[model samples]
Target: MTMADDTDRYGRVSRVLHWGMALLILWQFLSAGAHFLLGDTAVEEFFWATHKPLGLLLFVLIFVRVLWALMNVSRRPQSVNAAAKAGHIALYMLLVIVPGLALLRQYGSGKSFEPFGIPLFSGFEGDETPWMVAPGDLLHSWLGWVLLAIILGHIFMVVWHRRSASQPDVLPRMWR
Candidate 1:
């Protein structure tokens, strides 16, 4: 699909951001699962450490992607159908909101917010008040599962469209 801009279907920058974010998301989920399965050991600690920083990185990448998308709107692949379009929008919204709510949960619990060893908020004492940690943790956990569900749904739709509709190149365009 040609556009007014003289760029490849996906362009190098977009492809980089897309894959980078995808890898980070995968790492986030796996690390979280490891934390649960391993349970308070060094391995769990190690994975948790990676989780916060990686999540923060994903947040930053999302910002970059938003800017890139705004600047290079014409270069994005055309939507295959209305469902695809809705799914795209839902994915974007979830990506942005999920991390944001996680961050908010950290903040609202009066926990330190750190990204890459840099504290987003510093020197804050945690709340001893009941329900502070519990609610935040619940929301964070539930939203994480919901995000995973949406991601799985998105992948299924992509595969279905590609295989059934003979649009095998649909996903490749985002990396072209």
Candidate 2:
């Protein structure tokens, strides 16, 4: 029950953020899936409404998690291998980039954003910023799906590593 990350396993705060983000990401994918697979139906409508607010929430959570991760970097367990380390870095990058691009697009589109009524964006008076909107429109959904694929790969690697020839189960570090 450590409160900070140690060399052997993640601490309570890290575990909490890791698992919390997992659930949130799962919900986000569900929302995306509904939007992609169900389109204009009631299910899509229901899920889509939550997507924006949830994305903002995930963004904030990730920001905090990154700061926490930085604080605990020296104390965290070593990566099992280069691949594991790269995968982790990629995951973090995509987590930030996907939502980051979306928010950028939101602001650039000159549409007011007040998720949970916080007034994040104040809206503009002319045409949308094509640059911001373009990158987001081009990469957001695509990269989002890629992120999902990477996450699936991450899950597989976690389980696969549990049976690795050289180490203990990696799952326990984050899960237990």
Candidate 3:
């Protein structure tokens, strides 16, 4: 198999990042769902604990994915149209923004954060940084759901394109 993307299909690394992020996003949503719908339960406890660390993981993965995409841009398969291209751009933006806001809030909370024992932030003394905390508090969950909606739309577009006679079956670019 090819290690780099071609005009017709994604390379191994691209496919791994794409699908890997997809799965992580799905798990993130599940954690959020449990927190929301199954509050104060073991299910929520199990899933919610992973939310922050996984969000941090995703934040890092997205940057790597973005750089990879940029590096492979010229050789990658073409987007179906302006809308498809725009949709992808939107996806990438949300992927960055959602976790970014959360990380901001985390730093603002005046608490140490050591995801997977990496020691990302050491707690600071004095009052918490409200400015940093506020944006993430206000937008993190909201943008996350928005991200979910957009992802669903993306999946729909893919399926629609595959089933429709007018468009190409684009899944093979990443899947096959």
Candidate 4:
């Protein structure tokens, strides 16, 4: 109920950031899925159009969420265990890295990126910077799929915990 986190649960801001990012990430995956399975169709194009801008927004939100987490570290609920802590760390890392690679690729391509009509960079006239583009090209999609797998694992754990009598229902910490 409070704006700031307490030892028992996440605060309003944390929950908002957590749930908001979850929804955004879900949308991103939908876009990716459509692009993969239904390429060249209206569905893919419609979803793909929102991908870049939404990714940028997600990157910004994750940055803010990390800062907020740090600020509230002492007051926030403790991780259930080391595994839970590590899982969260992995999620955060992927959240940052995935978009970061995309941004790097965008920059290297020297193509004008105007996500949501806000120009982040202008296009250049020469060849793309191979170094910046390479990592993304090699790992972006693969790691993105890995991130999605990890996310599914995360959700599975949540459900497992919620259903197990011996385990704690941690959802209430973030959910109202």
Candidate 5:
């Protein structure tokens, strides 16, 4: 199968990354939703347990995806318009920013973080850094909700475009 993206459809690598991240993002949202709506319950506990590690995984995957996208930028299917291009750029930004903020707060919390046993951060002594923690505390959850809203809008636009007679049905470009 083709591995590099072209004008017709996403290549094998891109499709795999896209769909795989889609499933992971769906799970991430589920965990977030459970934490927000089912606090102190078994459901929350079950989903929340995977939140941090999965977020780390997503951050890593998005990093790779970004690199791959850049490598194939000249060949990939074009964005339907300026708004679609901006929407995608926004998605990429949020994908990086949201988890990056969490990672910052995690390190600043003076706690060790070894997601998937990678030993990423070692715990530190002393109070957590206010500057590092504050941005996450103030913006992480809020921005997470905002990301979800944009994701929903992204989905809506996909369907809307598919149905509009004048707009291209773009799903197949990414889907297969």
Candidate 6:
């Protein structure tokens, strides 16, 4: 269904990408937590090994999403206010940047860049100095947390807009 916002409800491709990435992100977070709790056992190592591939998948999906968004900018829902616009932009930016940095950190640590079992870069080597790896790791982890915060804020705002404002169907526009 088309939305009153003038955007066609998100097409099948967009919906698939959106929901697929969401699941991947959830898996990543859960896997990370599992690694933390389970330590370096086989299960934890397996989860850690999966992280790079999943992250790469996210990176590619974000790239596709951004390109799709750019091509269909005119069809996106209009923001109800400046705050909404800024928040949306921030979410988009984080989606693009966070995965990118995570991939970079993997590379910087001389690890393989694998996504979904496909090796983007194998036997990759970078500055082995602790300094280089440290900064990359720190930035990657910090940005990830920030991205999570932004996502939560985005959700909260959407819920607020739907419940407190007259627009009870704000989220459906994205589906549209």
The best candidate by TM-score is 4
Instruction: Name the regions of candidate 6 deviating beyond 4 angstroms.
Output: 1-8, 41-43, 124-132
Model 4 lDDT per residue over 104-133, tens place: 999999999999899899999999999999
| Candidate 6 lDDT | 0.71
| Candidate rank order under TM-score | 4, 3, 5, 2, 1, 6
lDDT by residue (tens digit), candidate 5, 43-153: 999999899999999999999999999999999999999999999899889989999999999999999999878899899999999999999999988888888888999
In angstroms, the error of model 2 at 80 is 0.4
Per residue, candidate 3 scores C-alpha lDDT tens digits across 101-149 of: 9989989999999998899999999998999999999999999999999
Q: How many backbone clashes are present in model 3?
A: 0
- As a whole number from 0 to 100, the lDDT of residue 151 in candidate 6 is 77
* Between candidates 1 and 5, the lDDT winner: 5
What are the per-model C-alpha RMSD values against the true structure? 3.3, 1.1, 0.8, 0.7, 0.9, 3.2
Candidate that beats the other on TM-score, 2 or 6, i.e. the better one: 2
Error of 4 at 3 (Å): 1.1
**TM-score of predicted structure 5:** 0.97
lDDT of each: 0.73, 0.93, 0.94, 0.94, 0.93, 0.71
Candidate 4 wrong stretches, greater than 4 Å: none
Model 2: colliding residue pairs: none
The digit string of per-residue lDDT tens for model 6 on 152-173 reads 8878877887788476556675
* Descending-lDDT candidate ranking: 4, 3, 2, 5, 1, 6
Each candidate structure's count of clashing pairs? 0, 0, 0, 0, 0, 6
Candidate 2 structure quality by residue, lDDT tens digits, 31-115: 9999999999999999999999999999899889999999999999999889889999998999999999999999999999999
When 1 and 3 are scored with lDDT, the better candidate is: 3
TM-score pick, better of 4 and 5 = 4
The 10 consecutive residues of candidate 6 with the worst lDDT sum are 1-10
If scored against the real structure, what TM-score would every candidate get? Answer: 0.82, 0.96, 0.98, 0.98, 0.97, 0.80
